[model samples]
Target: TPPDPGDRIPTGFADLDTLTSGGLRPGRMVVVGARPGVGKTLVGTGLARAAAIKGGLPTLFKTLEMGDEE
Candidate 1:
């Protein structure tokens, strides 16, 4: 079953959570867009790590640009 839409999943960053009104909402899609070398991957991995480790939420990560070793 899907999580409640009103539920927020923290990203392990206080400032980010504040900006996003306590973190990301469940059952919503988020897109991170930026120029190259602007920490897009860093932010994405951080969020995934936070969700999986801190929030204890099931997460899925898929990347077309990176290989298994990366």
Candidate 2:
């Protein structure tokens, strides 16, 4: 069956979109974790840029070391 267009937020990466069956679904969580200085922030920013900019959707990138006031 074809995926519902409204159900996805394009990951911007072709491979990611394929692996995710179009893109990340609404109301789901995706975790990218690793040790210090391992490009975790790069990955997070890439996703956020893809969704919020190219894909024109709201995006959030949270960190354990920072908060709304930081």
Candidate 3:
């Protein structure tokens, strides 16, 4: 089953959560766009970490730019 969209999942960053209006809502789309070397992957993995580790929620993160060998 999927998580309830009504509840929010914290991003593990207080500032981010605050900016996002109490974290991110489930079953919603979010896009983080920026230039290279600007910590885009850092932010993405952080959210995945928070959801999987802290929030105990199911998450899947795929990167088109990197491979397992990279």
Indicate whether candidate 1 or candidate 2 has the larger TM-score: 1
From the highest TM-score down, the ranking of the candidates is 3, 1, 2
Q: Compare candidates 1 and 3 on TM-score and give the better one.
A: 3
Q: Where does candidate 3 stray beyond 4 Å? A: 1-5
Q: Give the candidate number with the greatest TM-score.
A: 3
lDDT of 3: 0.82
What TM-score fits each model? 0.78, 0.70, 0.79
* Per-residue accuracy of model 3 over 1-70 as CA lDDT, tens digit each: 8877667888989998999887899888667778878887888889899989877888877666677985
lDDT per model vs. reference: 0.82, 0.79, 0.82
lDDT by residue for model 2 over 1-70, one digit each (tens)?
6545468877777998999888888666778899977887787788888889876878898877546785
Task: Give the per-residue lDDT of model 1 (tens digit) for 1-70.
Answer: 8887777889878899999888898877767778877877888888888889988888876665677998
Worst 10 residues of 1 by lDDT: 58-67
lDDT of 1: 0.82
